[model samples]
Target: MPVRTSPADAPLRIAVVADSDTRWKWGALTARRIAGRPPELAGFLLRGRATPTPRQLAEVGVAADALREVTMAEFLRAAEREPYDVVVLALVGGAAQAALHGLARLWPGHARRPVLVTGYVGVVYEKLADGLLLRHGADVVLANSRHDAERFRAVYEGVGADAAAVTEAALPFLGGAPHTPEPGRDTVVFAAQPSVPESRADRMYLLRRLIGHARRHPERDVLLKLRSKPGEHTTHIEEQPYQKLARSLDPPPNFRLVYGNMGEVLDRTDLLVTVSSTAALESLHRSVPTAVLTDLGVREALGNHHFIGSGCLASWDQLDAGHRPSPDPRWLAAQGVAPGEAYEGAFDAVRARLAELLARPALAPVSPYYTPVTAPGYLPGILARHHLAPDGTPLPGAAPETEATGVRRLVRDAVRDAARGAYRHGVQRVAPVIRRMGEL
Candidate 1:
């Protein structure tokens, strides 16, 4: 393959591929931040179980120069056909790995490929090793905080993989004015996750507590900041929605469910509370009096364990008693919550690394850790899920017809809707019953 080179002053053409609303927000924002100047941005939303709806995209409010939905195979084909300065894989671990391997196959030998980047959307509490290794082959694997960057490097080095790819960066969505106490009405927002408190009972318990808090303090406006509506899917599967749980117990007028941009909601919020959502970090970044609920216990399963030393842990009882938790300054700094210049410069390293990569005469092929030789048993299954062979070639019938039209398009949409409905039904209705039966 011939060397693919471009002038240093040329405008960058960046592409971002994301799976869900949250990742899309992270990817789009990160792309802009690292682009140095406004570059040509193209967004690809992967068609998957958690594909964000139009409403979800609107709620996120991050626009790309061009946006479309594509399957993993389709995206590979597009990448092969087009040339991009940078490609951000804002996908889950398996999908990212699949794409990396497939891109390597498409752009083999000395062919210059785009600077590949992948990272978590927010706090990294679960699947440290598995996820990190899957994202190992990206040219840059972003770590959202210093703490995470250290852990990511440790994991890669421990596994005998290159640790140089771990780049320290802050979550792209972390920005808002410092929280100011409202003079007349104190707004308390509970940031709700789709599946953190997975059980109906646990969700009901939290809702009842929120309602109790509202009843106890009628003067204060309590808001349930929901991530998604009943039908919309997010990063995680919402087995039991708080909206449905709230209906069982009629809540006070002052307490209501609200959905929109989290930053906008945080603008008026005095107290922000959550189980383990990334909203806690966002709230802390803005100096909001944030609380991580300990009612569910600070267990790893709940992910509140990540806040163990942050000094933000509090129960509903404590919150109701007017005990607002303040984050430790040291913890805040380590978590990349530094305000002003520090926050602004978080993506500086990423930009520099990208500039270096893009300036190279010819780059090596995408070398993911999980290859046919490395994990013969596991790698193939992951690729097969995305309709790619172990060697990264698309399987038969993997590509969809070019833009289904008329009746065909309508039928396709209907089938997708039915599939989504079935998934929701299984999650919200059937899964809980099965779990209860297992408990017996």
Candidate 2:
């Protein structure tokens, strides 16, 4: 039996556990829209780069008290003190996956163990293993599109996940009405993924292609939008920065490196290109000419093979020939790109489902396999010992980083980077082995 709580008297308390700006943005937007007046929102972020940026805070207009940095142990401790009604995991990484497994272990049997919801921030094609874990770990998994939801459902069924957990939801980062392409703006933006900027050879090839495109269309202003500023770490550490390449190449006057508001940049952008980014999808939603560059093979992480047959890709040859990319009507319908009738149906369904969840005062669905005692086996024992106890109590005096901890982290990062390079180069044969190493 569901307890119909009064929205005015007792607002639903939501805790957004996130470690990235992209994920936090989604959580903040959802809270702003869904949390009734006098918002009961607490944004718990991990320390360092994961902390919400001032710009991000301004964009969402999140209350100062609402956003705070907390260590994993601290967050767990606070949850034990006063649990939220809903815990939204705004994460999509190995760390987040591991954290979810830990949270599942720590919260079971608690009186106020909130319903957990996890979601991807953007397009997901080849990352099925993590996707499966996220789906099974959370009480509800938010899918960005109908195609994605169906795909996740099929995978969840295959993985023996509870079939009732998935729900289709729009990405809150893309909040405004559908973008209409403006006239007289002949700007082309290559949404750069500086973090893990493909292979060195691939990077050079892409730069050369963009340069060639600019040469062919001198009237077009081409902007290379960087993922982060030089020396700044965001999610993945970039071994090679595009700024260095841009400086060496000495691109044409029309070609420039850009970093600022993505929406504003897209407003003036007539054409958008990327290896595989959420930006490509955003551009498509705006009705702009969007191209998924696939000079890299389908097997490569940046291939973006999902859009291959969808008519959104500009292959190496296509880029060379200066061909205009077109979107497949059927693909758009299947992908749930909106302003269409299909999107409206999906959006309404998601809102209705969310309303039903909000109506209930508590969301506690326990899993026999994920109790705190069992979670340490899935994650590293060290993480479990450092973060929480079997009875959901956070370990004391383990929250702060000491000098020794900092030194150890530096060494660990170097090793991880080396292993990542080896994995990228195909030196590592087993996917599971690499996945486990990634968790480390």
Candidate 3:
């Protein structure tokens, strides 16, 4: 396949559309890693329920050449108007599918279109088939590990969809100095997830155990690495925030809540613990002694089940007894955590694939597996939720609005915050009460 090489005067122009803080970090970092050269990178934050605030963006700390927020329709319009060589859809499956169809419609038959890329932010433990099918049309669907790439291809091939799109690549944000044991102060960082243990009781139990561990090891620093503040949203809705729950408990002086880059925290970390956060992969990549808690069982719902054979699973009791589990070398390699040269070349294949796609004169239209024809009963609703028509056009009153300013912008911000607060309340408080009432 012929590879397109941009002229010396012109750098590759790449666009990344992402929702939520985690996806933004993944998308922005991935763009830079795959650019090969210092490409002109543009970032568009999908303005919706999970859009990260400025504070969240700062905490994640990944930056682009230019960054702005856009609705789905606005993004499609921008893609049509701009000359981006590659467009990464760093969004949820449904949003990605909608964008794929929309782009296909806008650049119909023999028209030049950007090389589309889509993928998960981390471990895929649920909706495997559903998510893969939704992302089927992209030029590349990145898999953070060889294990994920294999599974992604199998799902596509099993359903008779093209599996060539599945590309094996390591997580872009997985680089840091190798772990070195800190003298005197052994820091134990428990990476908290937004919704792994969805129930309040479960979250509280984990918090109590963390407190117990801190008490047991008074000389050590026990940090709860929280994802977001109470009012902020993330990739998943955080119902029972550890911050709120921690306020109710009397934790030791050594025990404290922390918010910052996970990599920075891992710099001093002797042990990294989590139910299941992508932070585990980052920790493993840096050779930090890591543990996936088995106190809550290796259940699929909790996502720790993905690490069942990783050899990193241990109970809090085991950790308390100074048992630092070492991950299986084979498991680490398979999960794209290979050391030295092997890890460095993890994205080679995908980069080559992107170059080849870019070289094509007139690429084929985006053809996702789930269309109005293939999934008549399902696809429309998904599109409609994003205010998109089945054909990928924005619905009435859904066209991109001009950027609001001054009083109007303030009102919009206020309204959005209130809505998010209400949603969090429903998830944390009302839903549990309803469930209890149903049980009664």
Candidate 4:
């Protein structure tokens, strides 16, 4: 069916809440293209606790009216005030997904509610359970590849989501015109993410290995790309900063920690190494030689499993010997990242889907009903981590708790808190150099 709006009708409104740089660029570019100079296009820079800096906004080409900085709560209240036709979310983080659930519950059965469209902003391996939960909250789930779309559908159906909710959409590559390698500047950048449990120990190992490689091949400049600055908050709180970690080790003359303008860095980079970073996909799209570090095993949480059997990933042994890996065409195609293909189809699909949704605003299904044992007034503390009890006073107990159950709960909390404290202590104590190295 055709979109209800004509050229003369009011321009469609879109609200984008981005959690990261890549997702922000994706939303901005897609919204800009779809909106096409007709009128104002509003969006949100939802960076959790961190606000978007002017430098960050300039880098992403986000204009003043194009995107406003807002918290999840503020964004939801705004959605209530002047309803948008669609809301594009970079629902990659836990808090973001949880916020979506909160919004869903808040606006139950609202016929004019905006449709939520989300996708994987990076590698997906063990996150299927979380992805399913996200699907439960969203109206449409965008898949990064045809393979991913199928995978999402199976998971959604398994979780009893509507069959029409999932759709195929390629991950957008906003870097215009892939660059060829410049002669005499052989830069090898290791895109690091230390927040993943599997990568914590292995990340340091890989860095030492990279140092060894850099020492052996002094002609090549090695750069360690970090995610965030020390003491800054990201979606996932990084335990150890690689900068602090690297400070303890003797430095190689050719190696340095590099940050900022990831796309520009990739343009000048000849070889890129990482552990399941979406940057690998971007590198592949740019025809840069890229490798997924397999030092960490293919556990679901580590997300290295996605690269198994794909030639794009290199083993620790392989990278240790200075072997550069190329992405297998078949594997790349399966991941829906083959070159020269129209990556913009995903944006087109989003636009079309939004148009359809706007035409029939009430098409999205209401969530399945559930009966809570506790009353709504007393449920905020249990249901929400961020939402507090009334005036900071604890809510009345839903039911009398047994001694055994209370003790068990206390024990669980104690253990969890202790483990978290130990991890944080290790990270803080070991803060010599080379701290968290991935998101930025």
lDDT: which candidate is best?
1
Which one is best on TM-score?
1
lDDT on C-alpha atoms for all candidate structures: 0.89, 0.64, 0.88, 0.63
Over 1-440, each residue of candidate 3 has an lDDT whose tens digit, in order, gives: 12345684477888999989999999888887788877899999988878998999999898888998888888888888788888999999888988888888787676677899999899999999999999989989999998999999999999999998899998988888888775686999999999989888889999999999999999999999999887788988876788988988999999989999988999999999999998998999989999999998999999999998899999999998999999998999999985556778888988899888877887887888988889999999988988899888888877646778999989988997799778878876787779889989
Clashes of each: 0, 2, 0, 18
Lowest-sum lDDT 10-residue window in model 1: 1-10
Please give the lDDT score at residue 394 for candidate 2: 53
Please write out the lDDT profile of model 1 over residues 1-440, one tens digit for every residue: 22345676766888999999999999999998888888888999998889999999999999888999888988887887778888999999999999998888987776677899999998888899999999998899999999999999999999899899999988988888887776795999999998788877788889899999999999989999999888778999988888878887889899999999999999999999999999998999988889999998888888999998899999999999999997898998999986556798998999989989887877787888888898999999999999999899889878764768899989998998899888878877898789999999
Better of 1 and 4 by lDDT: 1
Query: Candidate 4's error at 20, in angstroms?
Result: 5.0
Candidate 3 vs. true structure, TM-score: 0.95
Which ranges of candidate 4 are over 4 A from the true structure?
A: 1-11, 19-39, 45-71, 92-110, 197-200, 320-322, 361-383, 386-440
lDDT of 3: 0.88
Candidate 2: stretches off by over 4 Å: 1-11, 33-39, 48-65, 97-107, 110-113, 175-183, 316-322, 340-345, 368-377, 389-393, 400-440
Model 4 lDDT per residue over 100-121, tens place = 6555655655565766766666
Give the least accurate 10-residue stretch of model 3, judged by summed lDDT: 1-10
Give the per-residue lDDT of model 2 (tens digit) for 53-76.
565555434452477666676666
Ranking of candidates on TM-score, top first: 1, 3, 2, 4
